[model samples]
Target: MVGSENEARITAAEFRGGAGTAAWRVTATGPQAVFRAVSLTQAASLVGPAVEAAERLGILADIDVRPEGVIVCVPDRDFGGISAAAIAFSASVSTAAASLGLEPDPARIQSVGIYVAQHSATDARPFFAAALGYEDLGDGDAVDPLRRGPQLAFNPITGDVPRRGRTHFDVSVPADQAEARVAAALAAGGRLADDSHAPAWWSLASPDNHGVDIAAWSDDVGD
Candidate 1:
């Protein structure tokens, strides 16, 4: 992680987690500071001067800046392909961000993540990937599906969603990378999500079970 002497100390701090520890609250002092996790030896190259700036400004006071272990998210909506869903989310997030005044350039960001699933027989690879010569695998594939897509190029007018069967994989990707992935999905004619991804929520489709949990919608409906 890149930082000034003062910020470097912050970036190097140890983090605690249930599964693993990460470098916590890493700081840098510069105009376009970026704080991301890296091996102890690769700190300087991966961490950049921009992150140092954010640190000098005290942005790390609230969140964990440099963290270990991959954070993953899966879409509540199913796409015909895992890559398509990731791309859809990524593009939509960027459009939303630009409308909000945070104009972050997509190229400088590092490390995007998405989801994979345990596949059984009868599950087909997403059409886009299969067309590109990616083979399917049992249990799962060796590579992540969404990482291969166009970046940051989406069309609001032509956006769509490809229908998915009951069984599939749900993956989470970093917001910026998700934008690039979404561009690809849009190019391939896939649908985007109406709701954002969050940990406390998940969707399960089961014909046998149904419940009316009115409290979930109360906050949005003026209750």
Candidate 2:
């Protein structure tokens, strides 16, 4: 959901991880922040429970939403399949105290995502993506999308890159809470991609070729 549409910005995103239940570092703008979660939650997981509990306060005021695209990254080892992960929601702000079921300070939240892996022939597919946040890049408390930008190209283990250039972010949620997040996005009028719509691994293995495809929320849908 990333492009200049109706004066609104749409951006596609995804995530990656080396192991299960790992602490994920999500870069939003600048000064990257980190979160912990698993990697088994299905791409189609965050569609029910989260939505039932969270609510929208205003237009683009409480969620992260983006367009659909592809994200490619080199793995530590070769595998039979691929899996792409993403967080879907509108470009909005969320209060941890208001949206999440748990009790946290009602601070602004950027539509953030975690990373996923590819193991099976059907793993290299993107579900949806989003980044939730409050202030723009000016505020120190807010994430600087350009500063904490996604790793466009880099080596998996050493994080070494041959050439420095713009690259897509590899962000996805842990498998454990994938469903809950998806449900929240949907309830906010967001949707995740069906596994069936995913493409084959061979179709998207080039290191230089990476992207993330997320569904954006329309005015009516988000409302």
Candidate 3:
């Protein structure tokens, strides 16, 4: 995780219509193996940056644009380093900043956090590690999925709650390890939420009350 001194935090992207948190907001209810990027421009403009970032990360697979947001899908393969999630997050952040006429600091993105209405800060760690194969960095303060990008962090609500945002995790795993991953998730701090992995994915709900999706990439969505 990037230190506080080196980090600049920005939660979800807000739009011109005052549609707050619409930038990186997940639009659905179940565990989904995709990154959500909503905008007024049919999700294409929103995903433009992600395409660039994914290529830079060398995990370029393909993307799907829904009316509400764009789904940055990763193929069921490796690209030397990490892949989708971070690229999607960073790309969305950058796009949002650009839309708002502000500059996004890539070097300062410490971690992407989950907004929990109520929960212990430490509760999210084990589930993320066991479910999504994220490494517990700083015990519970941050988790490193390593495959995608950025660290996953916890964000407990303080005062007024705006919108109940969904915690998104587009986890990538091997076909053989799929069941074990599901087992670990349940045993640690997560419970099975959905079987979106269908032909190849598993979705789990964490103790911190967030959804985690463990999946291999697919190219059939926008093809």
Predicted structure with the largest lDDT when compared to the true one:
3
Query: RMSDs, each prediction?
Result: 17.4, 19.3, 16.8
* lDDT by residue for model 2 (1-223), tens: 2111332322222222222212222222211112111232321122233232223311111122112211111110111111221111111111221232222111121234223332223211122112432223221122333323322221122343433332233333323333444455456654443434322101111233453322221111111
Q: Top TM-score: which candidate number?
A: 3
lDDT of 1 by residue, 188-209 (tens): 5444432243221223222333
Look at candidate 3 and tell me the lDDT of residue 107.
18
> What is the lDDT of every predicted structure here?
0.26, 0.24, 0.43
Which structure is stronger by TM-score: 1 or 2? 1
lDDT of 3 by residue, 21-134 (tens): 222211111111233334546456645566666655544344555544444433322111222243344454445546744332211111123432334323555665677666
Q: Which of 1 and 3 is ahead in TM-score? A: 3
- What is residue 4's positional error in candidate 3, in angstroms? 38
In candidate 3, position 82 carries an lDDT of: 26
- How many residue pairs in model 2 have overlapping backbones? 67
Model 1 TM-score, all chains together: 0.22
